[model samples]
Target: MTPEFGSRRTAIVTGGAKRIGACFVRALAEDGWTLLIHCRESVAEAEAIAAEIGNGARVVAADLATVDGPDRVIAALEGMPPPALLVNSASLFELDSHDDFTAEAWDAHMNANARGPALLSRGFARAVPAGQGALIVNLLDAKLAQPNPDFYSYTISKMAFAGVSELMARVLAPQGIRVNAIAPSVTMVSGPQSRENFAKVHAMNALHRGVDVDDLVRALRFLVASPAITGQTIAVDGGQRFLSLPRDVQFMES
Candidate 1:
């Protein structure tokens, strides 16, 4: 983008339809940002959130698991002022242990969780003006620090993304773009997890508390306002990384 072109106070959040993604969308909106809520198939939820925020937040649709998804998301920024922030909050968290893992499932997880965010960060860096200083915050999992066999594909994909964040931070620092990540512990229910299991696992951290939407909002705000911090992952997992759980908390028997 040319220096002559000014940027908007805009942010794009992938998977901004529900869960923690939607929470970030609302938080950014409240911070006076024009939100571009990106969703794959949950367009209705995205639209609902947009309407609730009443800030003219637009919903962009793209399956990040597909080849054209990142491009499609980046294309939405065309004709509009450049976005100041890009939150790679969308992820594929399907269950596939090592014993049951398949190439198809692994590829699917990698495409959506790692490759898509990496490409989106690249596109976002290019789209930003020469010195506007943009930030890309990727959502990661705390389980990555002490990985278990549970959700093997998902864990591997996040590991790849963590590496992507570090690499991009080094390459983009001179260009005034910062790439960072946040590792959140299990805050919400996962696939097929019963309420009992969720409660039991949510407290399995050093702080005895799980990550929350407020924790994420605070972290993003700090990153957005801080100009000196880059290439670092701030763990908001309530010290979950310090513990060594043999299995993902979800699978631990009560």
Candidate 2:
């Protein structure tokens, strides 16, 4: 029998073309969701995922680093049912220290990681039916808990988004929309790292292990299925946030 679908069973995963974003998209798709996989440049990969899923999954390409990005995604909701799950997973992770801050870097990070998520959250809340329950999950870095100067601009933007997550939860709960975040550790090979270094860094956490795609999928599934888990930020980072690291985990033992 074919699966039943509804707006309340729909999801939009930003940056859902590759990497962790694509992982989220696949997870939700497997759990029987009508997907709107949003991508920026990785259109081919996004299309492939959509084609593979074959569940009315659409690929939306928009610059989540701009104000109009949310509009395009929201507009795609027309005629189709509004998404009940909006994963703010797109981000600009560039290197910038406190001493090297520049307007370009700041704007790019703020727009993509902070402003874009906030706008999309608002759009998602509005699209959901009044007093109908829905969930919005933000993908944040575990480093936000252990603040650092490395990736300064990216850190600041994520910090801003963290604030938005809680505040939006409080503000949107009246509409029955839940807002939460998942802060994951060094889950993937990011930035500049040799295979050896990546492996070493991955196990530096308290659990001597790294968070993985399945771990995040579990957290997201919990938030989506739970009826009373709002304003919460779940760290699936093997206790990385509990440590007092002065720099990013990758640079800690280097």
Top-scoring candidate (lDDT): 1
Q: Write the per-residue lDDT of candidate 1 for residues 1-254, one digit (tens) a residue.
A: 12322334678999999999999999888877788899999999999999999766788999988888888988888765568789999999988898999999999999999898888888888888776778889999888888888999999999999999899999998988888888888878987789989987887888887677899888988888777889988888888778888988888864
Q: What's the TM-score of every candidate structure?
A: 0.94, 0.94
After aligning candidate 1 to the native by TM-score, how far in Å is the CA of 68 from where it should be? 1.0
User: What lDDT score belongs to each candidate, Candidate 1 first?
Assistant: 0.85, 0.85
After aligning candidate 1 to the native by TM-score, how far in Å is the CA of 173 from where it should be?
Answer: 0.7
Which clashing pairs does model 1 show? none
Worst 10 residues of 1 by lDDT: 1-10
